[model samples]
Target: MAKKDKSEKKKKSAKLKDAEREARLEISGDLGTAITQASRSLRTVQTRLLTRSGLYSGQEGVVLLLAAEEGLTPGLLAQRLGVKAPTMTRTIGRMEAQGFVERRGSDADGRQTKVYLTETGRATVDRISSANKALERQATQGLSGKEIKVLMKLLAVVEDNLHAQMPAELPEPIDESEDLAAE
Candidate 1:
């Protein structure tokens, strides 16, 4: 009877271990989906707030960066903003048309162009700051400060992990000539 009881206990423990493993697997699979969904939702909220300040989703970073430093080339802006030069050019053109920023030839270098915020753009800085504060408040409405800090730390770790896995540069193109020679 005692032997049968011990056997039953071992089987129950094995079942529990399997159940825990499945739970961990499910959570690991859900992490990416959760992060993506959260990001989309946050962006939606941010866009809505930015619209009130006469800016779009990507324009705020440009405005804020230009506000801090009066003149920056579109290429520098693209690099800092993690976007391509052409995208930054389009954004600058739109902002110029909207009277938010203007491009001028660099005094130090005749060929280089520098972007500067207009009076309208400078005025919108306060509004942008307010919007950011409001967004933060709303996002952290339920969370404690300690929880928010932990979340930030966890996210940084995740971002670092992802960055570590990404290739530093694209692979070189294969030479068709070499391929033909090999063939």
Candidate 2:
């Protein structure tokens, strides 16, 4: 009954292939979920650390950027920070109210306003650096240098792939201001 044996073998092979495909799909789904969970946890930790500096989750980026190069326009800041103009404007307003940054009319172009870090913001620079180093140390506590390097490279590749598939016009960013304010 060679024909019967061959038919049974073929059926088993097809089942195995199906099982492998399902496993791959499950693994991919888990990968996405894990990435999302990790990102959220990291942000939560960062927010907690930033609160000590009287900064929110997003304001630190503005402070750091201005620390490096002062007098950057809100539009340029938004572009560099990968956020919308409205978002940057809101962030700058909040920072100004907190006395971390101040805006002034540009000498070259009166219509344009440039942002600069205030004394308070500069003072927090060292604290922000310490907070960041602490976070890094905590996150990579068990990981080797090679593992961290590999992880960074893998994340970069994933980010590039996702960006390549994104549309020219991205969706609006989530408004985390309320959450930050509550904190």
The candidate that wins on lDDT is: 1
Count clashing pairs, candidate 1: 0
Q: Write the per-residue lDDT of candidate 2 for residues 7-124, one digit (tens) a residue.
A: 9999999799789867766775777877886788788998999999999998888988999999999999999999999999999999999999999999999999999999999998
TM, every model: 0.74, 0.75
**Native-to-model Cα distance after best TM-score fit, residue 122 in candidate 1, in Å:** 0.4
**lDDT, candidates in the order shown:** 0.92, 0.91
Candidate 1 per-residue lDDT, tens place, 1-183, comes to 999999999999979978986776677577887688678878899899999988989999999999999899999999999999999999999999989999999999999999999999999899889999998898877589999999999999999998788877988987889889988
Question: Which regions in candidate 2 have their CA more than 4 angstroms from the true location?
Answer: 1-29, 167-183
